[model samples]
Target: MCPCGFLLPIHKGETLPSSLTVRRCDLQRFLKVIRGAGLLSRKGIPAWVSLDASSGVLRLRAANTQVEVQLQLEAADSAFEAIVDAEFLKICSGKEASSVTLSLADDEVTASWFDADVPRAARFVLRSSDSVPPAVAAPEILATNEPHLLEALREAQATTDPGASRFALACVQLRSAEGRIAATDSRQLLVQRGYQFPWAGDRLMQITPVFGAQEIDRSQDVQIGEAGNWIAVQAGPWRIAHAVEVEGRFPNVDLVIPSPSSLVSSMSVETGDARFVLERLDKLPCSDTLHEPVTVELNGSVAIRSRQEESAAAVELVLSRTQRNGNECRLQMDRRYLGRALKLGLREVGFTAGGGPCVARDAQRDYVWMGLGQENTISAADVGDRLLSEESVGG
Candidate 1:
């Protein structure tokens, strides 16, 4: 018997005819796809794996008051509808087998696996309350063949709020008029634009940053659709739907973004050097009270400095081209947040200072704007003079 009280009918020498049967390989493939869709729930409300033989599709669905994931797989054969614990069916499919047969008799559903050397089988008695979830209506098609949609979602994921206080910042917002996707966690904002999609209206949906990372094949074209309160994505054979919640408004991120003309000092650094500096800064003790601000000084060259309670460190790099507007500028910002932009692996990263927020981006449209710290406006000359005075005193 399975852990969920699924009886092994074949072990009892019963010969119940199967109403639906398919190859073991096909069933395994379906399980893998649904598992990657983030629909395999094990606790709280029971996770159900429902088979609709009438429609020739299998489904795994789980929902809470805030989130819902419904994944469907094509090519399932069954005579009647059967719903069982998702984990139980996954285990049954995991057995060594060449083919698997499913039998629906009364409220009990039997799963039997056949192999060249041995045959194994298990049966799950459905509860009276167990029923298949109603199918979601087909959503309106928004965009297709857009590769940057996933990229934008990935970048926005870095800025989404994981806590419950700011409910709206936890979702990625798609703006139809601007053709962009954006997200923010109050401290940082990431926006990706230039998506060639025929969007009819704006849509906001809550989706995990990790969604579609493992489920969708990069080579296949992708489609985005919306209906009711859900957004559906179909990439190749993989499909994912996210239920929308929390209708709160996203902050006006454009107000925080500094214009390029307003920058006092701008510099460009190799991607490798930028990543190295950020990684080294990450090792230093960070200040929780002020969010570990890393100071960048641009004069003749570039210098990155950070201090954690009296332990101070600095890294100097000559691998940059600088444009100074008759004044050396220094900007302080959160090191970790800044690192997220630098790690994007762009060939060259453009950094702008003396702005409301520090801006970093590549040649393309990808960009990240990080909040400036309280003591953000120190001049590079002032920092140099202070360091010299301190060294003289120590001497």
Candidate 2:
């Protein structure tokens, strides 16, 4: 016989030819019985969907009685349907079934397949398959968005695994509508709210998981479904098993947004905005075009610099060109964290230059506000030398 266990031998004896096949009627009847009666042991070793290959029929013994389910593979329009029984399909739907190990001790079901391995014959412990994670349930949905916002969010990496937890947890205080979606993390925040206010909710903010942001890169449906206590998220080919929402309220975020800046009337051109925080930092002072980002920009009229008297190198976000008449502003941030916000996006941008408060307005709506943050300038021999060498000196 071949290595696959097919019957192959010298043409002799009373054995039938290898070309013979099982009958159609018999195959159908066996499948019907399994579909109706057999108790599927999903956690059993050599766990097969149809009847066991070695055992001609599947058997479930209870007390003094025994029930058998017969099954065989053959051609028929409904051949596979008999295999899709309620309990069987449910088992297959789980994350992935590693070697199913049935825990039958003295002939009784006990631990999950991943758990206890019972003794077989005289010795030899079997494989584990006992711990079955609770079935996944979808989160309690707070808001829903149209396909457009979903698409744009994908471009920014919102639906992947990294972003799932963040997106799911940030469900509170959300504004659900048809335009955009936004979330934040432990460090910074975001506000991609409105069509004319494309974002939904009282404020534009988020706290999404890192995997979700990665999912955003892949444009696909992100449907959340839950049954009983299990939470499930279907994004592209990935299915996220999320825990049920714990009882609690998300923190308030509106207190953090900075005020908006008036458009400089005199300045004809200005730039500097990145898709994410890193890009924003990169464009901080490369050149004119480098500084100008159509969606968001950082332009100041005065140069602000700070260096410490003790140690630590001083850094600043200078407002290079003030053609439109504005104060110079410096925004120093951890390059990495800044990049994360850029990916989430903003509704409007504001500038804080000349030590004066800056503003960020909701361009899609009438919402506008001011923000207060702190950082000390590195004290140098004087502010003059610091100003001259700063990146904002020219534009």
**Could you tally the backbone clashes for each prediction?**
0, 84
Residue 225 alpha-carbon offset, candidate 1, angstroms: 1.5
> How do the residues 1-395 of candidate 2 rate in per-residue lDDT, one tens digit apiece?
01111122222222222111223233333333233323333344122222122223232111001122222233222111111122322321223222222222332222122212322111112222232222233345512323344344332233222333434334423344533333334334444555222222433222123232332214654454343433333444333332323443444445554444333211211233222223334433311232121112234343333333324344343334323334433443233333333333432334454322233334442122222233342333333333322243222
lDDT of 2 at 150: 37
- The superposed Cα distance between candidate 2 and the true structure at residue 314, in angstroms, equals 6.3
- Candidate 1 local Cα displacement, residue 156, angstroms: 2.2
TM-scores of the candidates are 0.76, 0.39
The true-versus-predicted C-alpha distance at residue 263 of model 2, in Å, is 12
Candidate 1 residue-wise lDDT, 108-190, digit = tens: 77777654546676667664442544555556665785655666666776678857465587777777677677778877777
lDDT of 1: 0.58
